[model samples]
Target: MSAKFHWVLMVVFVCGCHAGAASIAESFTSYKLVPNIVTKAPANVISVKFPSGAVVDLGNELSKPQVALTPSVSWNAGDGLYTVIMFDPDAPSPSNPFISSFLHWLVINVQKDGIASGDTIAEYLHPYPPPFGDIHRYVFLVYQQRERLPVKDFIAYSTIGRFKFSPQDFADNFNLGDPVAGNFFRTQFNSLKTDKLF
Candidate 1:
């Protein structure tokens, strides 16, 4: 291949990759997830596909996830243990999320790439934004664990009320550091939602 042609192809590939990354970053910032839940936008976008063929895309407004079990989460990161946390930063109401960051799911000791075999710290709670509330952001964050989080120590996290949970504090206590990959979707209360828990 001519050197000029090879260079042109490389440029196209590079630009394509950059645009994909930029979209995720822009959406996170647009939805305020950058400053509210995470200090920085994660470098990778984690894939969250639900059983009902629904995929969670950054900043997209979704109805209920269509399943009670945790959605399938996958990421293309290094081989090692990982942790996944899903929460709502806008609990009760986005304008007044006093009980902010209501935990929806927590899985630790996740093998690289998938959450199917992970230890479940908190079973997935179907999203049910309060009837009177505005849109809510359901965020999924994947952290590369420096070491295996001791199962016994994290078991109590499930028992603790899901409300008033802090993903930042949990990461700090466990030394999980910043998330390597993340994605979020916006949802709001629908009175006609067939899956309403309340």
Candidate 2:
């Protein structure tokens, strides 16, 4: 990929796979962000964008049929990339209230700014989901950055304050306990950095 255009990642994972049951009828499997999700790309600037149409209503949270806005953004930063993350805080969880879970909906990276709408040239990212799980809510968020941010792992910090993680910190945390954390952490941390678009 040229510096002007690089591939971003979009990912999805579910829970039912481990539960040993088919996905819930109305549960959210995954979500996708398309070019149409954004308003428009700049002319002189080659930029990547993501789906910002997601809306979270505690009343009626997101499900499989109800797609959340997938986050897409520029990767090289020169052309500009956007990253988005969408999740359900109230997703149907087990008895544990604090032990919140996350479902990855959009872990995609757009190649260029002018990719035609409905074009599937983009890529999809699949994190870990109980081997064959299904029907899980993933929060989709988008972050815009100036370059491709590389990380080693994913670290779960409830807030940004506990410890402002650099890309490296994130990479390590994700993989520390969950063998599946490194790959997912790398992608998720990259998205978080792009969020500092100013």
Candidate 3:
């Protein structure tokens, strides 16, 4: 084979491998949970790192030390404004999820990079699973917006009740098409202190 042909083949092989790896990673239950609820296919993968330097992976069990502080989130958004939402779909308890999908945090007009460049529509709420609650999935979803949304008109505050949260309804209300990126981590009941940011 010609040298140039071999080079092209190598590049294709590498890209294919990378894509395959991403596909496998996104298949985890934690990753699929968001899409299943939102009725959209997952896109970009978010990288979340806690203050203690622990990296978040699909379904990884995190305790108070791992979730006490808001983790740094980064994702690949080519351009345009975006929105970030972090919520727990297994609120109170999984078996009896009467108040499922409690909103933890919300930000609007996030730049292509991440939350740091966005407007804080809702302040961050640290994860605090009830002592008797089952393992909860805290999901972070990023959506590319058609335009800057009138979020303030919709939500008065970030710490709203868990009963009213509906990811699908939120997306439809704001015309936020399918999510551009998403990630999640699991946390169970822990004895460590859970402090409020305020």
Candidate 4:
């Protein structure tokens, strides 16, 4: 077995906590997207071209492929923290109010500075891994941390049991055309203050 699995089992055993070990809240339906790894998101404008390189064809539902962010961005104060978000506009559920979004992958304090090719988000899937399931929309976000986080688990601030971490709070600064939240709405980040020192 991979060392990663052993490490996970050990953590579970040590704490005596049998958490789900995966994102059980929701899933993505559009496409298979992983965080940090660069991918192309097609333009939303009808006249604009799509990433898969096609125009929006409403007739053939499956023909119109989905597009996502390109994995990183370049901004001044904030750029190291990255998150993955998925949402389905047609899902019948509580979070989906016709615009509900499900958080698929959340990676905090990624080594934005020295990240080279061939690096996957797998290194920091401590509390959970990416969730897979029905028609879900996803967004991978990168935030600029005022300070570098020394967390091994991406969800370090996320609540597993009694205590909880409000992820919304961190990304709140960049919400709704807000400079910070809007910075990473659907873009990649580079040139963060914290240069990776590994």
For candidate 1, lDDT tens digit of each residue in 18-80? Answer: 898888889888888877777778878999888877888887777863534468888887888
Candidate achieving the largest TM-score: 1
lDDT against the true structure, each candidate: 0.83, 0.27, 0.75, 0.29
In order of appearance, the predictions have TM-scores of: 0.91, 0.28, 0.83, 0.30
44-65, model 3: which lDDT tens digit per residue?
6778888978777766787766
Q: Superposing every Cα of model 3 onto the true structure, what RMSD results?
A: 3.3
Off by over 4 Å in 1: 65-69, 196-198
| Total backbone collisions for each predicted model | 0, 44, 0, 21
Q: Which ranges in model 2 have alpha carbons more than 4 Å from their true place?
A: 1-78, 91-95, 106-138, 151-198
What RMSD, rounded to one decimal, does every model reach? 1.9, 19.3, 3.3, 21.6
Best by lDDT: 1
Task: Sort by lDDT, best first.
Answer: 1, 3, 4, 2
